[model samples]
Target: MKIAVVGPSRLPIAPPFGGGLEVFVHRLVSALRLRGVEVDLFAARGSIGHIQSLEFPGIDWTGFEASARDDAYPPGAMESEAAAYRRVRKLLERSDYDLVHNNSVHPAMLVMDPGKAPPMITTLHVPPQPELQQIVDTLGPSNGRFTAVSRFTADQWRIPTPVDVIHNSVDTDQWRPGPGGQGVVWFGRITREKAPHIAIDVSRRLGLPLTLIGRCVEPPYFRKEIAPRLGPDIRWLGSLPPEEIARTVGHADVALVTPEWDEPFGLVIIEALACGTPVAAFARGGVTEVLKDSPAHLAVPGDVDDLVRAARAALQQPREHARRTAVRRFDIHTMLERYLTLFEGVLTR
Candidate 1:
């Protein structure tokens, strides 16, 4: 099967910028090629270059920053993204792809008349905000199919499109448990919504040294809301590389994931699990789904005391059992196979 994957605009499939979506695209393309499927990746410019390409057979990486293009859309925030979709549409028009899998939320999907194009499938990683929701609703029917990373995200938007739930997977081998490192770990974007403050409170209450990893995207808010409370026990270690993250998680006695909002999916929770580290996250959104049968513990959202109790319990759980759960359920192979089934179904239709 010949497939085209459209990735996000801000980051591509290379170092320094690729986040969860980039990792997903790269892994999916590599896995598909291993099964003898031909794949073409369409990503943003500078996000991926020829040298950093994945050396998998039957896979091609094409870099184009449509979102950066002036002619792609009006000179606005999403102009380059719109331009990218226009380019993707043209590519589909002139190519023989069996399916176009769009990973980004591009407005151009609505502009393209479905009847004249090959079938397209989109995976919504994040719940759409109100405006994006309108765009998705307009393009949903024409897009042929839709998949959400989690049921919580799918329901949050109340999208009219028929949706399938496909949970994200982790590379179990790469993230497997190593010797526990130093202290407790709190890794993710340092936003109020993620509840870093809760993690801090928990760490303080337990007297366990906590390491905070992730970029502080909002400084003013962090300074006012989060920074004033930091003490010697909490070390703010910005974002680290994936291997480092795994190593730090492996070294940790427990990983704290206390989110203030209903997180669509807790990628960090699964990653921690893959490292054989038990997680104590708030029982909300997909956290419950991910930690459903694991040695991990869940607490009520925003309750620091409950979170502290859960963290203490996580520290006491058997590490071997946690590792087993991660390998059995959230392994990359399992997720890859599920996605393959979905892709094959789309191709056959």
Candidate 2:
């Protein structure tokens, strides 16, 4: 089947990326091509090779950093996004693809004239934004099929359009078992919402070394809340690529995934599971969904004491069990199959 995959224009789909959406898109494209599906990726310039990519010009995520800090959009952000929409619309008007799979966070839906285009499906990778929600509401059911990364994220949408839940996937083969060491690991964007501080607290309570990874999205939060706590026991390893993360974090005794906000999905936790490493994560949003049937390792969100206790219990949980269960539920193959089914169903209707 031929498909037009609309990737996020804010960032190129490359390694050491700022967000998970870009990585997910790259993987989806690779998986689709391996299955002999003709896929066209609409993404930012300078994206990595190996796929049929249609580059689009737009402001990167760095342009919106200030607005992100203030919980608003940058002044020219919308204008840049509009230009991207126009480019995509023109391409769709000319192309004869079977379907368009939009991964863009931008409101491309506004430019997607359903009258002239093939069936489209948009995946909501994040919680609903006000402006995007307004556009979805305005379009109603005419905007085509919608899917969310998780049920927790789907529930956050106030729009009347039905959203299917499709959990994110990880390549289990690349994240094989490692020789586990003495400490626990924590990784994510070093923003306040991820609550890296809580992970440190859990480590300290149990007297285990906590290796912290990831880039600092909010400098002030790291300076004010996280830096002071850094010491011999709490090591800041900084951000590493996915291959390195699998090798490094896999060796840890356990992983601490503490999210202060309602995380749409915890990719870190699933990656840890794929590495045969037990995870002690807060019971919030998609954390519970990802850790289904592994309730013994979950603690209340932001509760350090409970997290410590859970981590201790999780240490005794078999490493092989975690790897086996993760492969069965979250393997990339399973995710691809489900997506293929969804795409075909949408076309058939």
Q: Give candidate 2 regions above 4 Å deviation.
A: 50-78, 159-161
| lDDT, candidate 2, at 77 | 68
**Which ten residues in a row are the worst by lDDT in model 1?**
50-59
What do the candidate models score in CA lDDT, each in turn?
0.73, 0.83
- Candidate 1 lDDT over residue span 1-68, tens digit each: 88877776655576433356767777677777788888887776565431224211111123332222
In terms of lDDT, model 1 sits at 0.73
Runs in model 1 deviating more than 4 A are 16-18, 49-76, 159-161, 226-231, 294-296
Model 2: how far is 41 from its true place, Å? Answer: 1.0
lDDT of 1 at 35: 83
Best by TM-score: 2
Model 1 — TM-score against the truth? 0.85
* lDDT of model 2, residue 257: 89
If scored against the real structure, what TM-score would every candidate get?
0.85, 0.92
